[model samples]
Target: MAKGGIKFKDSAAAYERLAADVAARRFAPVYLLMGEESYFIDALCDRLAATILDESQRAFGQITVYGRDTEAGQVINLCRQMPMSGDRQVVIVKEAQQMRGLDKLSLYTQQPSPTTVLVLCHKEKSADKRSAFYKGAAAHGAVLESVRPRDYEIAGWLAEHLRRQGLAADGKALSMLTDHLGTDLSKIANELRKLLVSLPEGTKRITDADIEANIGISKDFNNFELCKAVLARDMERSLRIAAHFARNPKDNPLLLTVMALFGQFRQLFLLNYLRWQSRHKGLPFPPDGELMRILRLNNPYALGELKQAAGEWPNRKVFAILGLLREYDAKSKGLNAGGMSDGELLRELLLKIFLL
Candidate 1:
């Protein structure tokens, strides 16, 4: 197993090490997996529990405990015991964040048993970095910090996920999935798995049609397409899509639509600000690589449209549009909204954005 530094590591890097160790049967003394992103933590835990020992060995060697039902001292006691029927014992602590006096485990973490593989599944928050337990784990074992990916990064993540499954998705399909599913990795993964299962054998590519057919997301009238239409100032197409959304309020929640627009306009506002800085202050726009890195933009193709929009929309207009989005977002949440239907608010917001 790869060793961790005296600090937390990013989820991807941490999971890579955990996966490698599990695959090789190289057990670490302790694994402190903590974060808001539970998917990776749960996944690593499942793999460890399933792969560390054979069924017969596991019957005696594997121990699973819930933090709410156990204390740090009990966990420490369990970690100290010798394996009964195998070369090593696997002790998994799920929801470790709920364990009272988790800091008390510092004493045991300082010198964990080499024959014991202690797994801590701390969900929804990270361990305290300043705590002795965190330091001890980092020194003796490994710490994995799972974080939720941002909205713009989802498409890239989905694409990579599909690639791993021997399937590929185009930009439009990626956009449609992200737009509809938002940034919940678990949900997105589940939906993609369903799509993959629905496909014929040896079908390697996922297209808009596949998405539309399997996921029930429209290829032409989704929020992704709506954003493109509005950015291109294609009023007819933009209003048409908005009308579709207004009609299908159940699938296309008005709040989500407004938030999507808000995100789009916010991106445009940033692009406009960068362009202005480049022209007036002699500052350069970030290189494509840096721009994607800083902006969390996975698709470079979207940059072309963004660049064009940045040139077309002045800073003032971008600012105004942002303010309007904010207002409509509030109204969509029923803040100062005088009983207007979601469809009405959406239509009104679209008109105002188009005018801007």
Candidate 2:
């Protein structure tokens, strides 16, 4: 699967590499942090902002300016100033993309301050590649461009994040968090921090229980159960779960719910397609090993429910369900949707799912 951020081998590798540099006290002359993934960009910038210069030196040696508040000229002048407290100084530019005439940074990069570590944090999107500022940052120092991790990639990221905090998570817990949090690393990291702090001391492994208790995600009524409920063709059970989600809209958003269903249906479609191929070719059914790889399943039992669902639902029906999911997903985002509430939309969608 596709992993790392843009230009890196794995999604987390870019962040880890830069973090290691920060930990090693290896400061670059100019750092350009650009990414759709704000988490790593912010994390890396925060580490540099907090470290690099000591508290005493920060009074005169550090300056943080926002792109909306400051221009390239002002930042350049600040960066060129000599440190008053010590030999090293730090100049951090947050939301750098919002800075007017940001390409003017190329002028400063040509003659960067010897005693300063200048960091430009471009959040939400990357800076223009053809711009001189990007080129100059590359010529002068380091640039970290992070792409958003996919849902599958987030599991590995969450594991590493927990490992650094002296914690681990179970397979089920991993699925719950990834589905709930999706690809937003900052949100996931924030929730995890809150979760970790609230846990009793000496807790080493995170389980579905920990998530349910601390994070308030009901392991019994979450999207996993919703998927299971639908697979079993239990309309009553499915509606009950939908009611639970409606009660806790803060925890179970409609978009996330729609996304979870899409993922489940996609997996079912693949399984049904495989089965169809086996039948047509007069070959033996594909084994669990191949199914595990195709489904990206971590455990054997995860397949049991999916296998059952695939058998019950034909490939054509599953394909149509995927289309229906996309339509509802758009409606959830207010595309061609009237004043229908999320609950209304979801209730209608579930009824249609059963009809299909």
Candidate 3:
């Protein structure tokens, strides 16, 4: 058991640490897991509860309390109490942002009991780093930091996770998964687990076909198909998928779809420009190969259609499309369009891309 403890500078780092801890069984005394991604924080808390704490001892000192429901002083009192029938006791506090008198808890954290493991789960965007509670936890206990995932890193994370689970997915499938799921690691992990379990053990590869069949998406309709259609300039198929996405907002969030599409386009555009460069004559387009070396990550599909698109359109047109994408990105968030339905927004963007 490695008890050196993992210090996550960001949310992705937090998940990686949690994954490692789950595998290694090195539980810490005070875990301050705070992040915007509720799923990761909640999952880590659940893992500790289910896998770490013993039942008889749980009754004596395994207390689960919410910040809104109890005061910080009360939690401190619970922590001060002795454990029963076990060498260690666990105390989990959810939504630590709502708890009152946390400043007092800060004072108590200076000398946290070795026998008690106090877990504070803070909600996303709510925990104040400047507050006494956060400072106290960092000063005295272990802190699991959480930072939002950048768009570029999400695809690689998905691929790496699949590899860890003894499963492989093609670049197309990986891209599609990230596109649909957004940058939520917890959700991505859950979906991948579902896919892994549905198949026989020791299954090594996952395809776009397998993903579509096992996941909630329809067999014939998905972001991958849509991207292919758009790249081929198949306006009819693009409209069909966009219309379906428009109808089912929950199944296909418009904002996420927009982000996914524009992200692909931006990457493609970058790849296309790289292809045009004599410096990259022997290099792959999209520069995925080069980027992987620079970023120290695995990504082989970087130079896909973007390089071709750059060659297909004049420099002016490519710049115009980029501008249009930026406008659409803002409009999807209701920034430019004060009042517009999701379907109408999708329809407008589709038309813009088609005409461009």
Candidate 4:
């Protein structure tokens, strides 16, 4: 789960199941869509709003409210009433996290009307589990926790997102998309929507060329190549890419570069450990598929770069490089840099890493 420090367990599977149910028009009495991942909350809430009411019914049957402007009693009162001109009523409460005295709404849970679909969208954090409303909502309907997917799980999540759009990304395209866009699902989805609008009709498979031309992330001078160059100890190529980044700071942020390098070194560090375990401890190496999953990789052949990089640096050196990454990550955030530019800081960090 990517909702770091949140106590709730990963809710990705529940999200999928609930989405399927909502798509099939399986309406629950009361839904508490609360979690750190607001993207999931918004997507599901929008789906419910779009699917639950017909165009003619929205004027009278579909009602929307915000937390700041209303109270729990008002919401409950709305839920208690019968639909104006339809059999079913859909009440969507957006940003319910800001609403005070939400627990007071629990009074209605005991006799929740079967004709009302009350959706409470509490996002960016989990709700108070001890609240009567939380317990009542869970017992009466659903408390969907929209947990964010971790770094390793994001690719799969993105793939599923694309699959739902009736599109797919080739392996290279997927890597480029994830690496360039990072794990912000809303941004990724927005980009995909825009890219789809720009592409020729009948285009289903997003290719590297499409990403490069449409998204403007270079297939050549991206952080992916820079990480590969650093891992392979190609100082010349690393410096060259760093220069390109220096020239185009908007396109190549140093912070993202640091993150990419950190991810690469993390994989290399783990690969080094596995290799040592196999050679010294007489443990069998993980199969290619298992190793791929560990690294969150799409291509089996990509293992060659990781294995080769592991051999190029010792464990201690990888640790030192990781330390460099952390230091630069901070420097990129203006922590202790004596006025060095982001590009300059990145260049210095790479040099220090390679020297390790």
C-alpha lDDT values of all predictions: 0.84, 0.84, 0.71, 0.83
Clashing pairs in 1: none
Q: Which ten residues in a row have the lowest lDDT in candidate 1?
A: 1-10
Q: Arrange candidates, best lDDT first.
A: 2, 1, 4, 3
Cα displacement (Å) at residue 275, model 2: 3.4
* lDDT string, candidate 1, 102-182, tens digits: 999998999999889999999988888889999999999987888877666677667776776777887788988888888
By the lDDT metric, which is better: model 3 or model 4? 4
The CA lDDT at 333 in model 2 is 95
Error of 2 at 83 (Å): 1.9
For candidate 3, give the lDDT of residue 43: 73
Q: Residues 1-356, candidate 2, lDDT per residue (tens digit)?
A: 31232542353786788889899998889999887778888899889988898777787888888999999999998888888788888999999989998999889876788888999999877887788878888888888887876665677677878888788888778878888888888889899989989989999999999999998888888887788789889999999999888777887889988988998888898888778788898867778998887886665777888886677888788888999999999999999778887888888999999998
Which residue segments of model 2 deviate by more than 4 Å? 1-11, 278-293, 297-300, 335-339
**Tens-digit per-residue lDDT, 55-143, candidate 3:** 65667758899989999789988888878757778899998877887667776677788788899888774355677877777787767
CA displacement after TM-score superposition, residue 135 of candidate 1 (Å): 1.7
TM-score of every candidate relative to the true structure: 0.89, 0.89, 0.82, 0.94
Looking at candidate 2, the ten consecutive residues that score lowest on lDDT are: 1-10
lDDT by residue (tens digit), candidate 4, 158-273: 77778888998876777777777777778888898888999899988888889999999888888878887887799999999999999999888888888888888888888889
The residue pairs in collision within model 2 are 3-11, 4-10, 4-11, 5-11
For all candidates, what are the clash counts? 0, 4, 8, 0
